[model samples]
Target: MDTAAADGTAAGNTTGGRPGRGRGRITSIEVLCAVLLLALLGQSWLRSTLDVPALRTGATVFVAVCVQALPFLVLGVLISGAIAAFVPARVLRKVLPRKENAAVGVAGIAGVALPGCECASVPVARRLIGQGVAPAAALTFLLAAPAVNPVVMVATAVAFPGEPGMVAARFAGSLATAMTMGWLWARWGKLDWIAERALRRLPEVEPGSRWRAFTETARADLVEAGGFLVLGALISAALGVLVPAEVFGVLGEQIVLGVLVMAVLAVVLALCSEADAFVAASLTAVPLLPKLVFLVVGPAVDVKLFALQAGTFGRSFALRFAPVTFAVAVVCAVLAGLVFLGGAR
Candidate 1:
């Protein structure tokens, strides 16, 4: 039995209506969500007619990016569901590295085996920590797994096609970001402040019916994950429209500002690492360095991630930890630009 099922949370009919017994009642939350989405779409259209080019542009980009990202989110949710249904917690804990530095090292490498986007990674991360994984190691896995995973690495390679250097930069940058943050956190970052919820016991998913477990886990994940994913998408979309087209150009040369801005965007948009490359591609004005910052930072921490982290760990820890990670990440990314992207030795 899954932990949730063992707890009886996953036993009843979640939808409450049989699949074929005529039809089912709609829940208030679902109805409200649909209404809100429709209203947002309508507002988007209404704003278009105003002839405000910036508004129209931003909305269009936002919507397009969100659409582009939906597939990734769906894929993430499905994969996460699969993990819940198939993999037992005790086994997963065993798959991790037993040593300290090795744990972080495995975190960088494990990105390949446990393949998925950031959204999917969140639950996995929580599960890892809950299984008595070391905090620094868990943090390393959380940061690196999404960024260095095959899905993202392949995309980065494609993004800078024929320019293998960019590919190398992407990989190195991501690794540096993960390891640096892990090391820094191990060295000075706050661990005691993490929330207690993130460490909650792993729900032992009962194999009542494979399909039922899948759906139940999927729904629970969606409910917990979907809303936060939406918030990230909305913020990213809003930025696509609201930020001035020329702003990136001006900020790009100001390396510090560029990195900070991208870091800020990372927090605000909370984009899935898998999809962030494409978003990075869209920031025409921002120099590659800043855009690189986006890819490096997105998977590590953001507003939605903060919420999840705070929920999972503790608010005080997240507040202290996220900022520290952010600062370290920015500095590391900058140095990456210097070493890899720059001609500096």
Candidate 2:
């Protein structure tokens, strides 16, 4: 009787333990299946709800921005991963100038080789910083890569046909903004303002495991940066739809107001640098200087960039850097315009 009772007790314990282990836990796959079922059930209602013009417009802009930026973002992360996995810090230091200031200049010039938009540059810059590159030089490349790249230049030229001066002015203005900011950060910026995570160094990759390190780093950065990118796109689309059209009508005759307004709009719109020139060109009422300001400011600082910067570096760094960048970009654009566009065309 005693042996039989012990066996039954053990059998009961085993049976009870299995259900207890999974009592309240839900797997991701189960949650996903439930969500899909709900979505299918609400398909008609969801379609009707999103059918409004404003929502439709916002949706289009959001999709356009995401579609345009995602490829470049992917490219940036892949390069970043390669840097982490393969490139030695010593080699990067050797290739760049010894002095931070000179390295900033080199970085600015190097920007011309990357033909991607602003989204592509951020991850690359962050990776450079993580890999022991000077912050000033990496920051310069961050600002310049999207602005001075050949694709952007060609787009600018096509947008403003026969206006070689606009193209020249844009290049000069953007380069000036990048280098100036780099120098300023070198002089006054604090490393502590950057997030600890951003500055954290990865463990050295074993030679045989380099590819594994590369893929893992790329995947991690993509997942983190991609969320901020989507958030920026959503904010930009909402602002784009909400801003009144009358604002453009009022600015044509007022050069001072136009420049300031256009600069603000550049920040708020968060247009891709490669595509911003066309949008600026389409604003027929605005003068050339204002359009130039828009083009320069959009790439250097914008809502999208601010979000990415805040996420990657930290809120403190973005707050300080973005406002200063905006001011510098505006001043540079105006000066470049005076020199190249012959005082606002």
RMSD of candidates 1 onward, in order: 8.4, 5.9
lDDT of 1 by residue, 93-128 (tens): 686677767777777677666665555566677777
User: Lowest-lDDT window of 10 residues in candidate 2?
Assistant: 113-122
lDDT of 2 at 42: 99
Candidate 1: segments with Cα more than 4 A from true spot: 1-60, 155-167, 185-203, 209-213, 216-243, 343-345
- The candidate that achieves the highest TM-score relative to the unseen native structure: 1
What are the clashing pairs of model 2?
A: none
What is the Å distance of residue 88 in model 1 from its true position? 2.5
lDDT by residue (124-200, candidate 2, tens digit) is 67777887889999899899988997767877887789899999999999999999999999999899999998897
